[model samples]
Target: MLDHVQIADAIAESLITNGVRTGTRLPTQKELGESYGAPRHSIRKALDLLEKRGVLGARQGSGTYVLGQLVDYQISSRTSYNHNVRRLDASPTIEFLELRTRQATPEIARGLGINRSARIFDLYVLRRSNGEPLCLARHYLSEDRFPTLSEHLEVATGISDLLRRIGMQDVRRSNSSISARMPAKHEAALLEIPQASPVLVLEGRNVDAKGVPVEISTSVWPASRIKVHV
Candidate 1:
């Protein structure tokens, strides 16, 4: 007889093999036990294990559901979010939330190699894959360098495209650091995940062909939705 751990492994594998979509409600405990030919207690244990692994989630008074497969996102010299999603045959979209000029903080100044209190363009955007929110990004760019950035960004396709239009032909990530933590209330709501769920924070600096800092970006991603490849 299979133990609870074995049953959990089997069910997880089945979910992958069957390509179960995220948010798809799973079978009841009774039905799962019958299908797995396991005892009810064993089925319950297996479901608990899966939930802990982030492969499944339970809704209050509802039922368990598949959490979906993790999307592979690469952090490389030339990282493009749209390209990454497209490589997986998924559609990607970026929605601009806010754009304005603001004084650079000490941290932002250091990231952009600019003086603190200098004017900078602050842009906030939400990234989505297949119509599901994937990440929220905050971008900082020197206002002096791109005075008309706001006008271009309002109609631009993405950051890369906007950069190209502003005469920055080559844009690349100079450095990136990743960390994990529980999401804030607004972040959880935006990502459509539970507040208890963790999120991956990616801090990245991008440069032009001349190696001059162009943009400082901070992105938050749902831990269950993406696997970062460094």
Candidate 2:
């Protein structure tokens, strides 16, 4: 007569006590049910709940596997995704979702200190750690400063490298703002998390050596996969 919640809690406890590392595949639903003295339906429900909590991932046709631990993200004036992930002893990667030039909106213009009608290079990037999607970001840069930036930059190199390649080696973070909210449908899909899951929003501007605003970006991180430290 064990409830699914109780079964899930017991499984979690067993995982901890048995030193179940990340990527360790759990037993089959039937096996788990037999071990816990519960039905297969209850065991499946328990695994589904664990998957929602980011504790496990259930692959189609494959069994559920542990998802290991969350990454500790340190917020600071000098923020670097690569550096941050490396500090956690993990590999970092970036994927470009968008890259194009368009007329700046009022908000984008204000953030980059450009005219509303000015052309801006808009880049949407997805960042990952240890092959897991961590966040999605949209960055805006004034096209006038780096006329050929669109041709030179690649998602793999990131914005910092792009600035350096364009002779803006001394760029630094000018300001930042942080907030929290549930993810949008598209964003949740990209992050591979539930739509009801919360995300940490970070908005910031970077300035060149002369303190001229050079770039502005907004990034959204899955709340469950990151521990933000100020």
Estimate TM-scores for all models. 0.79, 0.74
**For residues 1-230, what per-residue lDDT tens digits would candidate 2 score against the true structure?**
78998997787667755545568888899899899899889998988887776668988898788885356667676788788778767788888888999999999998888888899999999988778888899999989988977776553377778777877888788888889998998999988888876788988899888889989999998765666666
RMSD of 2: 5.7
Error of 1 at 8 (Å): 8.0
Candidate 2: regions farther than 4 A off: 1-50, 57-69
Question: Candidate 1 on 1-230: residue-level lDDT in tens?
Answer: 88998998788767654546678899999999989999999999999877865678899899999874446788899999989878767788889999888899999999998999799999999988778888999999999988988778667888788888888888999999999999889988888777877788999999988899999999999776676789
Error of 2 at 36 (Å): 21
The root-mean-square deviation over C-alpha atoms between each candidate and the true structure, in angstroms, is: 4.4, 5.7
lDDT against the true structure, each candidate: 0.85, 0.81
- Single out the weakest 10-residue window by summed lDDT for candidate 2: 13-22
Candidate 2's clash total is: 0
Please state the error at residue 164 of candidate 2 in Å.
Answer: 1.1
TM-score of 1: 0.79
